[model samples]
Target: MKSLIVNADDLGRSAGIDAGIARAHREGIVTSATLMTNGPGAEGGGAVARENPDLGVGVHLVLTYGRPLSDPATVPSLVEPDGGFPVKASAVIGRGRVRTDEVLREYRAQLERARELIGREPTHVDTHHWVQEEPGVFTAFLELARESGLAARPLNDAERERLRAAGVRTPDRYVREFQHPRAIDVAALLALLELIAAAGDGATELMCHPGEPDPELERTSAYAVARPVELATLTDPAVRAKVRELGFQPITYGDL
Candidate 1:
């Protein structure tokens, strides 16, 4: 049997985003979401998660956006001189000085903050901006998942292999093409689903960033304009029907 986890990322970034994610889960096929514990809408996101108990929520670990939950003085290597994280993963990786200890400290803080806000432990862990994929930080990311016993999102085959080797829970495959602006339509989404169906057995995760447009999101995210389109496609009745037609079992990371 084939299973799919449609995980919306960047939750808690803004009220508009939180609204979109909640709508997608309530009215669409979104089975899970990853929360940005330090974001502007974090508290609101928590409220929504509580309201929708079946929506598995997870920590969207951060190192490349916003301020750190840990004190800047404590995780200095993960922050700039201004005490905020850099805007891009490249900046974090290029520094080559991101201490694993610092990654663990900040990630742990984020995880704890998520638990406090959501009123429960998160279902899993994944990175914002795919920051956990950075070689310098990947080890720390794995260590956190191993210690927490939380499932994780592995972006590639190699990461999946490593996660399995470490005895951490993760899906067998990861698919991110649906978020591509050009592919945010129903036809594209259906086609992508078809591909996953053919990839055979095990679980697959489709990373998505569906949200409503707001000034804050527009200002902070380069991919903001495409969000509503993604939201529309995700919640479209046809896409939902297609998912069922293809015999894909929708599940949460916790189910893995």
Candidate 2:
């Protein structure tokens, strides 16, 4: 049997985003989402998660785009001179200044923050900007998942092998192209469903960023305009019907 987990990322980035995620899950095929615990809308996002108990909420761990939950001083290698994270993942991964210990500490803090706000353990863990794919960071990320006994997102087959070898749970495949603006349409989504159906057995994760764009999102995110388009496509009844037609068992990360 084939299984699919449609996980929307960046849930706590803004109120617009939180609203979009809620709608996507409630009226669409989004079975899971990853929360940006440090984002401005985190508290509201947590409320949404609680209200929708079936929505699997996970930690969208950050090494970029916000201040660290751990004191900046303690995670100096992970932050900039101004105590905020670099705006891009490259700034953190390419600098070679990141400390594995610091990454572990800061990630733990974020996970704890999510637990506190959501009033329960997150269903899984994934990264913002895929930062955890970096070599040094991957070690710490894998360690955290193992320790926390949480499912994780693996960007590729190698990462999947590593996570499995480390006794971490993860989907068998990951699909990331669905979030692009050009692909945020019902036809594209239906095509994606067909592709997943053809891939045969094993669970697959389709990563998406669906949200209602707001002024804050417009200012902070370059991909803001594509959000509502994704939201609309994701919430379309046709997409949900296609999943059922293709015999793709919809699942959440917690079910991995």
Candidate 3:
């Protein structure tokens, strides 16, 4: 049977987002979520995790958004004057502003924060903006995952191969939708589901960012409007039923 893991990213970005992730896990098709260690709603996300033990939680290791868990002095190249990371992933990777050792240290700090807040080690790890795709960065991240005995999200074929070479496991396939803000078309999401169903065997991960709109999200994220639409798509009865109709088994990151 084909397995699917609906992993929601950015669990602790805001209270609204945290609530949406909780609803998606409890009432919809979401099987897992990735928590932001330094997110504004981290406390709420921790509460949600405690309440819903069945919902597998991973660390959404951030490198391009919000504040870093590490000291700004130590990672001067990775932080802005405001103490948060640059919004663009290229600013860090393309410019060679971030050091590999600094990245490793910051990632470990974020993992530690996640463990403290979520009350356990994260089941897996994923980057905030696909920053792990950068050459040296992914290797360091893979090392961290291996040391922690946790899985990491493989965003593409190359990343999958890299993970395989390192003896790390990920879902057999990964699916995600990239869209402009407020343009989360449900029809497109459904089409993605159909495409994944028609593909080869083994487990696949469907990544989504779903949430309710609120002041915090509006202020912090440019993708705010798209969040609610994504939430609706995930919780839609039709979509949930379609997964069953396609004979897909919903699993979590841990299950990979």
Candidate 4:
């Protein structure tokens, strides 16, 4: 029994990204998405989610980039003076500048913002740049999940075990592309499917960033051009056929 979740991250970052996520869910093997409440296209992302109820939208709680959903004055330890979040994960978690209390408040704010924008609770919660994987931050985030009764995206065996022990929901297996531009590698994905099928017994997730190329995305991320290629790979019929051939069921976090 192998289930695969092709969950795209950075929804609401820009118009291009929003469109790409929507298309991937509608036309490709993508089953879910993690929406960024503080992103530039947040309102658009919420509207898109409402339009496509099957997408299984979740909150992409961010603390490492862009602006903060909580007032900057209120979360001073978490944001820069200018109100933007630090681009480096270390500045917040590693430096210990962001206190546990700040994380609790900001994370709840982001979750609430997501609910307000999406018009419903998210199916799950994950972080921008895997920020929740950091030491003190991870503990705080786990607590939030427990309190909210929301599933979380745990990337490794240890984290999975920790979450499960805490009575939280998560996938059984996690797949990440070691190569840069992970989402565009259809051949690699096909091979991965073969590998997972051979192993045979866990729910897994494949995280991706697929989007249309746009000036805003280019300015904000180094990942701009790779997005369109990723979009192409995800929407490719051959890739979907291969997924079916391998007998991997495409699912959302809701299905976990």
Off by over 4 Å in 2: none
**Of 3 and 4, which scores higher on lDDT?**
4
Clashing pairs in 1: none
Indicate the residue-level lDDT of 79 in model 1: 91
Query: Per-prediction RMSD in angstroms?
Result: 1.1, 1.0, 1.7, 1.6
Q: What 10-residue stretch in candidate 3 is worst by lDDT? A: 177-186
What tens digits encode model 4's per-residue C-alpha lDDT throughout 83-151? 889898777655756677888898998899899988877889888888876776788788888888888
Q: Give a tens-digit lDDT track for model 2, residues 7-84.
A: 999888889989999999999999999999886778998998899999999999998877888989999899889999
TM-score of each: 0.97, 0.98, 0.94, 0.95
| Model 2, CA-based lDDT | 0.90
Better of 2 and 3 by TM-score: 2
Residue pairs in collision within model 3? none
Deviation (Å) of 103 in candidate 2: 0.3
What total of clashing residue pairs does each candidate reach? 0, 0, 0, 0
